[model samples]
Target: MSIIIRKSLLELIFSGAFMKRWNDKLRPMELVEVDKQAHKMIVAWLLFLLNSRDLDVVRKRALGESLIEGGLFDYLYRLVITDIKPPVFYKIKENPDDYSTLTNWVIKQLRPRIMPLGDDFMNRMTAYLMQPEDKGLARRILHAAHLYASYSEFKLLKSINRMDHELIEIEESFIERLNSMRDLVGVSELLDEDSNVLGGFARMCGRLRFQKRWSQTPRVPETSVLGHMFIVATYSWFFSMEVGACRARCQNNFFSGLFHDLPELLTRDIISPVKGSSQEIGELIHEYEIRELNRVVLAPLKEGGYEDIAKRLEYLLGLEVGSEFKASVNMDGTIVEATEEQMAGEYNIDTIDPKDGPLLKVSDSLAAYIEAHTALKNGISSGQLHHALYRISNRYNETPVIAGVQVSALLADFD
Candidate 1:
């Protein structure tokens, strides 16, 4: 396929000097197309031409042919017109085996007339945009890009400002939504666990504290599925680290914490009232949860050869009651995997680091308590904070776990 752009616009796009000099002299010229494919590719090419001055001519030509050959002109056109630039070069270069000479040739030929934004920048943009459309970040980026691409720089700047304002608003909303979920998920022992997909779990948990609810559920807190996973994972890391567990164990704890409630995503956080109706009914629900978990999170990951991740989580969770994991497990560890009643059973398992569960639980409780206390400071004062703390303290017989650790008493250091 062949398409042509006026040499002047090509220079305008490629040579900033020419663009500046001929800014007034230049007039729009129709792009000549040799075929339907050529026409589509030219639209794609011109869209990019608007931003690229450093792309070599050879590369531009190659890009044109590649766009045509790969049936990517439409995608590229949408991207370019929307202020999103596709990675026409790097995606091809990164895996030459997938995109060999023909692809490379097209990219090289079309290179000169386009912008030379680095591949990393393009890839990050792609990743950001390609996320699920419902993602707040993606929506913000799309809105910003739409305004920027269609308007002059002056308008674009304002559009950017508005977009930022919207983002801040959304962030606040997200936080309000995630607060309850954050508490429920309860960042436990594995926040810093090491799994390829779960490595950022801690940050994710922290961010959940800020998620906003989109739905109205009086009993259920407004939180995102991702937010819950993040907090639980973080708690897992804290637990493991405080317990002085091995590095591998620490990572496993993190992964386990992240996925412990994954079944909830599939099962929809069944309330205890319904779940505890009868032994058979409860068992049936549990069975369904396990099956759905295996079918969704576990199966997909294993099919993708990510069973290692699942195993890591399960190991950290100590889901499989074995001789070895018993001594090392904490109260939260058992609670995550056990039936509510089973959790209350007189199971005497000595804590490993002695300070592990106490530190983690205190940290978790204190975080929520502080948040509630802050609300009191904001003129929403109720006896709720004090009463809640009293009830919680009374549960442990008022003998808190951090009694002996001076460092642990300094909860002010936590952010």
Candidate 2:
């Protein structure tokens, strides 16, 4: 059954961009929920990589799906209850009966926007929210990633928060919770200031918040590459579900969307125009990205006994089939391109380890369209931004229905 990718849901997810973090505290930069959610998922990826090293493919896929689902659940719930402070929210969460009531209310409020995702998502969301604390690996990873991402922001505000009496308890609580997770594979490195591989990787992901999207253009909320990746990731998951993608395939799409722009971290955010200026220039940039990615990202990871992570990253980055935007799947150990029909039919099974690259492309372009549309709506018009909106709109106008999604209609809804 092809599901409707509703306009309200897209706006609801993108709405996180406007939701502020550490709102009451003095901050150097505008810390938004979207970017923090992105960072948390990135941290969760490393944790997933570390902990799944010994698990089978089935177990690995289950854990990956749980992490993605849990993150989305938490994000959606927070979107509805925007005014509650972190301390107050946590206190409420501590009381199971009270939190259960609050969760039910949040579900009621969000159902209208999220109903397009269908019943499975709704049921899963409720179960995850109501699940006992620390009952699963996904929950533990969630706890660690939240603290790591929050602490990254808190460190920046330390100059202002140090003397604030209210934050003293919060500071100690963060450390103590993190201390309990030291046994988790990447948790120690995450907490360590000087640890090499994992520490460097986490820092690089966090630094993406400083790398603004559409750098040449002025916008209401200048989004970061990290935040944009999350948007695409979220869209891919929704599209995947709509297309009835199998468990592994859906998870693959989500993570592929999440890390799609990682090469940008090493090469910086090279705008699409610069890359497409000429065939030679595009090829040269691609060549450089591959060389640098191997050296700076993959090589170090493999050397640190993370060959599996490196290999999967290579696949998700589309190193084998040319571009991550192209649909492909792993058959046994070989990577092969698959058609949209095959993705919907034969290749849909989890054993194929399919990644719906075409679905991801739609998600990627839709995200770009929304970003452009949102900026223009906010009265931050520019020739470049307008061209972006036009190009993306026209690009999908011809065949709006891609990978079972009404792409053209969804784009039109933005207007």
Candidate 3:
């Protein structure tokens, strides 16, 4: 159902006490014109808040002080001075003091929610926003981030559809930048300590094909995050394309790969055998994962009144609880019965041809090679790798596979 949020209603929504008192109240069918504009502006503001590195609300709250000198005035001035048109400037100017008051009030209210984020991270995010040319693009990216945080994958489809081409492109570019962040040493390090953890986790998820090897390593290995993500993104894209899925679906598949490993950040990459011993053990481990993650990764954000990062991850992965995680069972001395799905939904691209199923098959093959390569790098035997390769070639012989030949060619890389 559609909710028509207006100014008066928004004031209530923004009011912490008021919102709590009428938690069940919903918006009506109609909105005043001013209210509609208000809605758009608020949406835009939220979009800006989420996507931009500048507004580190969580970090600011966590630090227990305003990092920016002018408080909300500093924020509004930054907004207006950076790419805001003359009319928007005039609107701000007409009631400058009132706007300042409203903005400060909003920030004060939000500060409680964002304080857990810490000051250091908040400063960096604000600095990113201070860059002039990035303003419009930043807003779009922030909007996508916010929508993703609030809704489901399907909701992302709707959100993107509702955006104008310019905004969509802006958001896409932003996402691309985020995808590429792991390639840089500074960015990867910064993300580990701050808000870009989402991006860092995405890169890890995309790299899941390298799991056993990655787990065995002392750490992620400085540039391994980039290397793994490239592999997953490439495989996901190739697989979806061969299947004839639409570009959008293919993109989502790539994103799915990117997000697959996020929970590992919180849970510390539990190996499959351990997780599969029993349901109770698994649940206990799951709870520990959430607790540790909140303490290490999300507790900082809690100071700012933000929701649980693990809970946000549950929404992203589309699971009600962590019980749905994949398990790998050792069937015999060199055989493993492994089943895995990173997200709740089926891994199918509607626009792609059914024949493209081979792409998924290829992704699996490439992942195996990455594991083998990593294992070999660490001086492990290639026996398991060879066994997996044998399984795939054997499957192809039994059925005609799309891009079967191309995939076979790529398998040579594993060897």
- List clash counts for every candidate, in order: 53, 0, 29
lDDT of 1 by residue, 223-279 (tens): 343333433344444344344444433443443433444455556656444676898
Candidate 1 similarity to native, TM-score:
0.34
lDDT of 3 by residue, 1-415 (tens): 2111122221222221111111122322111111111222222222232433354544422221221111222333332233443346447646757555644554455444333334543354445333323334434333333233222222223443454444455456445654553332223332342355544433333233223334443421212322333334335543454444443344434433334444565555565447767988887887777666556545544454434444433332323323222211212322121232311123232322111223434454455444444445556555554454576656554543333224544444444
Model 2 residue 308 distance off true place after TM-score fit, in angstroms: 1.3
The CA lDDT at 252 in model 3 is 37
Q: Return the top candidate by lDDT.
A: 2
Instruction: Judge candidate 2 against the unseen true structure and give its global Cα lDDT, from 0 to 1.
Output: 0.88
Quote model 3's TM-score.
Answer: 0.35
Per-candidate RMSD vs. true structure? 23.0, 1.7, 22.5
Q: Rank the candidates by TM-score, best first.
A: 2, 3, 1
Model 1: residue 225 alpha-carbon error in angstroms: 4.9
lDDT of each: 0.35, 0.88, 0.37
